[model samples]
Target: SEGKTSFGMSIFNLSNAIMGSGILGLAYAMANTGIVLFLILLILIAVMSAYSIHLLLKSADVVGTRAYEMLGLRAYGQAGKIIAACVVTIHNIGAMSTYLYIVKIELPFVILGLLGKEKDFGGWYVDGNYLITIVSVCVILPLALMRRLGYLGYTSGVSLLCMVFFLISVIFKKFVMECPLKSIDPYSNNGNKTLDPRVMSSHINSDFMATPFTTLMRSHNDSDFIPRFIPVMISSHTAHDCREAKMFTLTPEAIYSIPIVAFAFVCHPEVLPIYTELRKPTKKRMQNVANISILAMFIMYLLTAVFGYLTFYGNVEDELLKSYSASDTLILCVRLAVLVAVTLTVPVVLFPPSSSGFCDKWHR
Candidate 1:
């Protein structure tokens, strides 16, 4: 009891595990899948994830051991144990790498923004590799050294707050940011026909208001996976059109979005450890913790995907934040907040393998 974690902290830890850099890609995934299809996929994944946890907890109970590897051992001897350990190690290592990669990509811009320099300004400080090294040593390493998984709960709470800020910023930006982004070039200037901005804006306003209910569903053949440009009365105003909304899509891009959505919910490996540390730990209680955590992340993920997709429409980039202007103060702050969230998350991701004895040598 002395070293156990409360339900609230356990939720925080598990919530942090559920959320990561994967969230930034949800909008892009939505762009490919469309609003309706994406929501359906998301709800299905969340339900499946919870059900998977239920099976895991049930298995651990029957095996009379809390360790995932031990459950494997009971089921299939040493081979199962090793396979389990390897799978956990590989998955978590990949998760850690993804988190660090976010740090590498975004840290430079964050530092540059703080220093009032151009996003492209040159310096060793702005070098992603160098910044990642510094962050690894100064931030992640120390946190990863903690012996108990429960200790990281405080940092996890902080990390969740950062993501909440990111979510709020995305929702706020949806209202403030307009479509057919002025920063993006609609047409190449290489002796090509160009439309006047004033005329285009007027067309957007008039056509969008007059034909508010007009819907067009572009037909796509099974082999036609390429994104096609559909001509509309107004050039870029089509983004706001109901016709652009695809209830379902069979494109290769939509298929590719499946993995992104699936992987975004991978917190199963971390479940047992948190369950073991849970105060007055019981199968039913831990299940409640897992369910609540998944639900919270589900809300955040859905809101983030919907609002972010609405903001950028089909033009949304894989990394949603990258699609925004770096010079915007609000976006800059969101960037830093994201950096903090992911940086703190690396240590939590490291815990599964490290506790499994995968990092025994380093600890010794």
Candidate 2:
């Protein structure tokens, strides 16, 4: 098939769309719903996401429509087209807003790290609005102007590479580093135990409804593998301790985790456009591209969640990176990588909104 985009490029584009800052929240999700349940939800979400994409591809093939707006038009007439555009526009706007927020919050930290200045510069230049403007002009605007989506494959590839570094760093820190590393002074040795209980916890809050379902297990002890798993509860604790605490309770916290996972897997809007650009535009081929992308994200998500949860069992923070000591140089590098990834991702997200407008104009 003489498709415009190679399979590799297509996978990169889709994967870039699939993986976002939502990965940062997976650890917190796991902390709320124990390691086993978290993995189960992760797998279930991944499968459902992939299946949805498959259905989308099959439908597109049936109607010979490559644009989501067009697909809506075929099924629901003018109303469908308008609704699709509205939905895509709204979703893309929300996603871009998140990336904008990520850039606003992270750029200053990256700047400080580069300058080796811990305290704020005490100037307007360090202000988040100023940083967002600078990034918008210098980084995002140029990419958003590109007329072709294929060119973004390179940026997407680079962005995914940066995320890979973030993932690797998380794994490295989790397994290779000791619990009470003197460098991370917050986690000092306890009175009796060599490690602080806050460092790892076995306690899950009772506020949640507990379940006996078990799927997988991993703990601080590399050699120990136990199947006696219970649903985990998410709560804020002043104490940072690692205990073998297991409580299975279904609460609002578990319900809250769903949006993050859903947000992480949200790439449906980008699917049809990518399909249009694929080298072989067969439904099977597009499905293959999506499957590869989803599988890649699934693995990365699991690894990040498992390692992060293992590192900070019950006391996992909302932002996984926030759970770590800011002073850690290694973490600082990962922070920079995440900053770059999210910044570059702005244009990729902006594509859907722009395309929706363009298609609407052309069709009209």
Candidate 3:
């Protein structure tokens, strides 16, 4: 009771748990599902997540236990408890892995960008495996080792701020980036037109033109390579062709998009712990926390997905930040913010599984 967290801190922790590396991929999901359908799915998932939290809290009150596994045990038997614990453990582990993987992939690039050597990837400093290991040992390990979830409230607040900065940067970039109208030269072989190699490379390697030729061209120096391949390369196009954002449609990839949208609201596993640590723990108060956190995240996720998808339209990458030019100073700063946000989130995601393990041992 002495270390109980106030309502604001509890909200911070829950909000951090809800927002993670999943935000980076929402734009791609929106691209696949279209604007109207994506908004519908997002709203549905947020409401479902809040309702599930309410049910979980009600069940906990009835059983007189805050432990999720114990709730399962009361409802069923040993098998139910085991199943509940295993499911929570597996889901949190996957979430933690995803956060760390973002660190691994993006940290090196952030370091290189800060050093003004974005192309320099030859050192151990730029190695993703090494960066992730150092970060885990230096940053995440200490935060994860804290005995109380409340202690993470401060860090969670900072993480949420970083995401807000990221969201704002995304909206700003949408206005500044211009789509190249004549991104491809169709009559190059007929000696009537020519293409800028830089423009061509940007369109092929960075935009939505994902083809075998684009993949092959990325391996070579663009200036030297594009001239030789200009005669045969006719399939290449630009983001101008993809400027129309879909309003009401779904691609075959919606199968994957649905899961992405659903899982983006997964703060259920962290709800009870936050509730347990609340300054004035009550079902009504905790439900309010859940509602506020989900609502906050829903707005952030929607703004991020909408602006990000609008910027790239059909050309948006799985990672929204990757769709931008790496040399853009603002985007580089955004990359850093995103990297920090995900890195700090690792500790929050790590808590559920670790606490579950400690609970099991204490019970024994």
* lDDT of the candidates, in the order given: 0.82, 0.77, 0.80
TM-score per candidate, chains pooled = 0.84, 0.80, 0.83
- Using lDDT as the measure, what is the rank order of every candidate, best first? 1, 3, 2
Candidate 1: residue 35 lDDT (0-100): 82
**Per-residue lDDT of candidate 2, residues 1-364 (tens digit):** 2448888989999999999899999988887877777777788888899999988988888898778888889999989988988899888889899999998988788778767788797766678899899889998999987766678999999999999999999888887643321122112342122322333344333321222323345578855544443322222232334534333435468887878886778899889878877876788888998999999999999899888877766656789998776778889889989988988788888887677754547434
Deviating ranges (above 4 Å) for candidate 1: 1-3, 119-121, 182-246, 249-252, 358-364
- Residue-wise lDDT of candidate 1 within 1-364, one digit each (tens)? 4338889999999999999888999998998988889999999999999999999999998888878789889999999989999999999999899889888988888888888897666789999989999999999999999988899999999999999999999999988865533232323342122434334444344333222222323346644233233322222344345325555655568877899899878899899889888899889999999999999999999999988888877667788998887789999999999999999999888888888855668777
Q: What lDDT, from 0 to 1, does candidate 3 have?
A: 0.80
Model 3 stretches astray by more than 4 angstroms: 1-3, 118-121, 180-243, 357-364
Error of 1 at 316 (Å): 1.7
Best candidate according to TM-score: 1
Q: Cα deviation in Å at residue 142, candidate 3?
A: 0.8
Clashing pairs in 3: none
Please list the residue runs of candidate 2 whose C-alpha ends up more than 4 Å from where it truly belongs after superposition.
1-3, 176-252, 357-364
Error of 3 at 231 (Å): 15
Better of 1 and 3 by TM-score: 1
Cα-based RMSD of candidate 1:
9.0
